[model samples]
Target: MTTDPRTLIWSKSSYSGNGGSCVEWAPAQTTTGIVPVRDSKNPDGPVLSVPTRSFAEFIAGVKSGAFFAA
Candidate 1:
């Protein structure tokens, strides 16, 4: 059974459109414990589904500047 990703409502990230660092996420459908992420640049591209816990960790890291360049 294949699921259509278009049916999912995506929201633009806060960092979107800033220095080409944009990302979109499907949070409403994340009730299933998996978060869907796709490039804001290419909506028709393949999606990356990460576990909710992992997504949270990644977000926390972003907030904490864990992935920021020195």
Candidate 2:
């Protein structure tokens, strides 16, 4: 499914408080089962379209700290 990133509303994580390192996602566009993600610092940058289930798994991993160094 092709989507115009400019038409999507992006929202950043609340946990990103005062951090320059932040990412944004378009929940509105996720209705089609595709999650659009982009750097909050670079709105005009490239956008990544990930499957809804895959994005959910990725979020779970983050909450589980699976991405942190062991």
Candidate 3:
């Protein structure tokens, strides 16, 4: 399901901080149970869409520091 990222509403995480490395996601698209994600620095770049359950799991991993480098 290819879509123009510009057409969807995007939101950056409050934890994104001042660092330039950040991602934006279209929460509004969750109505379809799929979330579209893209780099905040590159709005015109490619978008990655994932299932809502997968997105939730990813967020849980982030919160649990599962992605942090040991």
Give the per-residue lDDT of model 1 (tens digit) for 28-48: 867888888999889999889
Task: Report the C-alpha displacement of residue 41, candidate 3, in angstroms.
Answer: 0.4
Q: Which stretches in model 2 have alpha-carbon errors above 4 Å?
A: none
lDDT by residue for model 2 over 1-70, one digit each (tens)? 4988988888997657675678899998888999999898889999999999999999999999889744
lDDT of each: 0.85, 0.88, 0.86
Clashing pairs in 3: none
Lowest lDDT 10-mer window, candidate 2? 13-22
Better-scoring candidate (lDDT), 1 or 3 = 3
**Top-down lDDT ranking:** 2, 3, 1
Residue 36 alpha-carbon offset, candidate 2, angstroms: 0.3
Any idea what lDDT model 3 has?
Answer: 0.86
Q: What TM-scores do the predictions have?
A: 0.87, 0.86, 0.86
What does candidate 3's lDDT look like per residue over 1-70, in tens digits?
5656788989997667676678899999988889998888888888899999999999999999889745
